[model samples]
Target: MLSWKPFALSVAVLLILFPFVYLVLLSLSSEWRFPDLLPSYFGLKNWATILGSEAGLLESFVSSLLISLSVAIVSTTSGFLISRAVFYHPKKNTLTLLAYFPYILAPVVFAACLSFFFLKMGLFGNITGVIVAQFIIAFPYALLFFSSFWNKKIKSYEDLVATLGGNRWQTFIKVLFPLAKGLILICFFQTFLISWFEYGLTSIIGIGKVQTLTIKVFLFIKEANYYYGALSCCLLIFPPVVLLYLNKRYVFKKLV
Candidate 1:
């Protein structure tokens, strides 16, 4: 008797992978117009543009990496430390609630609200401005995420560290940091993703001057350039995929 289980599993796998497969195919091809069963051309030609100055994709990719890395590192470290302070604060709940304020507004609205300050500070339409804007959004998320990492048990660890003649910095370096290492890495990964794919805040704050890979992808799409858009997408997905693999291999294993 023929069983349908294998067939169903294969179909499910193909369904899940179809979009990514199609995207790669699209990125490698051009002139795929209507009524044509396939693209008129296909090869490394589109991918090759990344090395040339014509695409500016290589620059965009580097800019995105730098911004995302900065935002992730700052947000994760600050959030972890600040969340500890909040845990010990009298109005911990209130402070924690305030962290959610960023999420209350839509990204575009939030950008608009922040524009006046950015303009005043001379942060308008530049890389620094974009980084600051993305940091604002990513920071609160990290803060909230680390909130759960602080509890009575963690407090006990701090108390124990103090009892052992450990200073505040010593406690963090020798104990707290090691204990929270997994969470920190995970937070970094999450925050990195947040900044990596951010569009609305980047668009408004950057004013199209700071063109990150996400911005490049949008520009390509807006101009009705699907081939380049797909290529940009392929570039955009690369870092997160590498991060995910590292997390799975190193972070998640340690976690488990």
Candidate 2:
């Protein structure tokens, strides 16, 4: 009997690599049209143009990096704390359901519903508003991600910490942090990618003022600049890919 694992792994690798190959081709090709198996000409012009000063993409990249890192830190930390509370609460299922509502809903619809409130609060069309909007979606996911940490084993450790005269802060700092550093990293990266790739909420809340990389990609696509769109897509995928590699290689290894 033939095992299916190798066949499945082969298909998975092809699925993952195919789009990336196409994206790289699109980014580098200067004259590859339909029916061409490969481009006759390839250069770094697309990369140079996007990164050059006139494109303002460098600023967009920096903006996205800052916003993603901020969202990751803020959402992950807050979600961890909130998840702890939700885990301990009597109505844990209800609280968890509430947390899932934001994340499970269509982000565009969620943002649209909140846009008026944001305007009323004078938060629309700014970086801060965009961060808050993203946090609403990312925080719920972070909460769910960290919920897995709140099991019987964790409760035992907490009880031990309490018996050792450790307060909540000490238990979290000394015990939970060390035990769950990998999970924290995973949550941070997940939230970071959520904010980094977020388009709808940022679009609605930012109102074109805050130009994230995802927004940049959309604008380029809207303008029919496929090359620049491909470039932006490449930039967008790079960090997450690297982080995933590191997470698999180092972070998860640390967990074990």
- Which pairs clash in model 2? none
Instruction: Tell me the tens digit of each residue's lDDT in model 1 across 62-109.
Output: 999999999999989888988888878899889978888895667778
The sequence of per-residue lDDT tens digits that candidate 2 reaches over residues 47-117 is 88876776678789999999999999999999988899999889999998888888789998999999999
**Candidate with maximal lDDT:** 1
Q: What is the C-alpha RMSD of each candidate to the true structure, in Å?
A: 1.4, 2.4
Question: Can you give the lDDT of residue 66 in candidate 1?
Answer: 96
Please tell me which predicted candidate would have the highest TM-score against the true structure: 1
After superposing candidate 1, which stretches have Cα over 4 Å from the reference?
A: 1-6
Model 1 pairs whose backbones collide: none
| TM-score versus the correct structure, for each prediction | 0.96, 0.90
